[model samples]
Target: MKIGLYFGTFNPIHVGHLTIANHLAEHSDLDQVWFIVTPQSPFKKKSTLLDDHQRLEMVYRATKDYVKLRPSDIEFGLKQPNYTIDTLTYLFEKFPEHEFALIMGEDNLKSFHKWKNYELILENHSIYVYPRLSKGNVETQFSNHPKIFNISAPIMELSSTFIRKEIKAGRNVRPMLSDNVWHYIDEMNFYR
Candidate 1:
């Protein structure tokens, strides 16, 4: 089976995120798309992250009913400084039968070179990149790289960052997140 690994903090999973997963699962070659909840991303600021298990539960609640979409805790068992290359390497060794691909936004593509062992990742796995419009995000050539494939998935203005800010301000985030997830967020007081 072909699987696409969509890694993120997912402070609180939302509709925009689900849409991307659904789009990939239905439209792409992927049989399933696992939303790997990263406990701590080496590239991101630690102050901005929610509790590890809490975030994971939110991800779980968000994707509970989607057959083609699932949540994973692979990074939770791994050591700190959750790097993509290391996670991918571990996944390769553990799930050899499944074809794995990296699913990331164009925003991440611009900073690909800064990642640890970026060349090794591009050299081995096929990367599925979705378009994004973050400031200063530029397009680069991945076709020249044999294992990368540039794809345009549904892009959204709703982001985990925006959702968090809304919650902190005591604003209604029901519109930002899925119904089930928003209920979980309210019950758990996630991001509060």
Candidate 2:
């Protein structure tokens, strides 16, 4: 299976996340897109961030309806402050038959070179980058790299920070979230 790993904190999975994952699954050569729920970094504490399971639950609910999109809690089992390279290595070892690729935005692509063992990742896995209205230009080395594919997916401007703030301010941001995710957050009274 060819899987695209869409990694994120997903404080509360929202529609923008679903849209992009679905787009990549349907438009690209990838057979499936996994929303990899990134575990919270123990060093950078944030009270707003939900527990790993809570975030994973939101992801599960948001992606349950999609045939090609699925949720993964793989990172939760790994050591804290894990890097993408670490997760990729683990996945390859655990699922040897599957080919794993990365799904990221142009903003992340700009700093891809800074990642630990980024060269190794580039050599092993393909990177699917979607457009983002970010300020910096991507590094020249990645411009024509065969492993780095610039997918013309929809640019998702929505952010979890903005959604959390809206929920805290008593705004109805229901439309921004998947129905089940919205219900879960509302029931838990998260962010409010």
Q: Please, what is the TM-score per model?
A: 0.93, 0.95
lDDT of 1 by residue, 71-162 (tens): 99999999898788889889999999998889988777877888899988877788887777677526565546667666777777688888
Q: lDDT at 154 for candidate 2? A: 88
Q: How accurate is candidate 1 locally (lDDT)?
A: 0.84
Model 1: ten consecutive residues of lowest lDDT: 136-145
Candidate 2 residue lDDT tens string, 1-192: 999999988987889989999999999999999999988644346566798899999999998889999999999889878899999999999999999999999887877888889999999999999988776665567989999999998889999989999998999999999899999999999998
Model 2 CA lDDT for position 63? 88
Q: For residue 159, what is the lDDT in candidate 1?
A: 82
- CA displacement after TM-score superposition, residue 8 of candidate 2 (Å): 0.6
Instruction: Give the whole-model CA lDDT for all candidates, comma-separated.
Output: 0.84, 0.90
Root-mean-square deviation of Cα positions for candidate 1 versus the true structure, in angstroms: 1.6
